[model samples]
Target: MRLFLVIFAVIIISGCDDSNSKPSTKLSEQQSSSLLTIKDESVIPETEFSIVFTPNNEVEIIDAYIEGVDMYMGRIPLFFSRTNKQLQYIASGMVGVCSKNEMVWRIYLHYRKNGTQEGKIATLNFVVTNT
Candidate 1:
């Protein structure tokens, strides 16, 4: 009889504690704006530039290139079957060059499941000066 009473008391206390817990609220716009914001007003150097692609699913990154530069092309096989969420890929070899001019780049992603084309092209302008 004592063990049964103790068990019942424990369950009742646990239920009461959970009922008294406050629900979580979403963050306000002002609070969240700066959390994930990117400030692009300031000019960044060309050598500091890179290309990024957010994939919608498990994808094999076929190639990333600076559009007109054939030598800049490269491939990467990515597996995201565990999660169909967004995944990011960054372009390589163009890290730090002082070339403050506009350039176009393309990132091509191949879905592993259906073999469909998921490509993205981005144009960025930044100043690059010889260091």
Candidate 2:
């Protein structure tokens, strides 16, 4: 009777552990679909450029870079709320003007969550006219 009771207790504890374990399979599926999509028109020189982030949610934006240059690395306020739903112009501070006549600037959007990279990086290319 003592042997049977010990075996039953071990089985019960193991079952509890299994229930507490995180579901890796489900988490992977969600992570694979997590992506950032920038839906804004191209930026023109001498004119203010407004970038809009769609489907704004709880995604933590690590940084926003333009043409390999850090625009809002740590100085500017980077937090975005869902109520706004748009990152307006002049909000991200000033960006350097393009010197070339026809320059193709690439905007990189980096995102993360809980200090871990959520595998979300979006790139948008825009031309900067000399005008």
The estimated TM-scores of all candidates read 0.30, 0.44
Model 1, range 58-113, lDDT digits (tens) per residue?
45644332322222222222222222334544543232221223322222332232
Given candidate 1, what's the lDDT at residue 127? 27
Per residue, candidate 2 scores C-alpha lDDT tens digits across 1-131 of 67545633443342211111111111122344443323324443323434444423455666765541222121112233343434322123122343234444455556655455554655544444444
Off by over 4 Å in 2: 1-47, 55-57, 68-82, 85-94, 113-117
**Candidate 1 TM-score, true structure as reference:** 0.30
Give the candidate number with the greatest lDDT: 2
Residue clash pairs of candidate 1: 47-95, 47-96, 47-97, 98-128, 98-129, 99-128, 100-127, 100-128
lDDT against true structure, model 2 = 0.38
- For model 2, state the Cα shift of residue 32 in Å: 12
Q: What is the lDDT of residue 30 in candidate 1?
A: 30
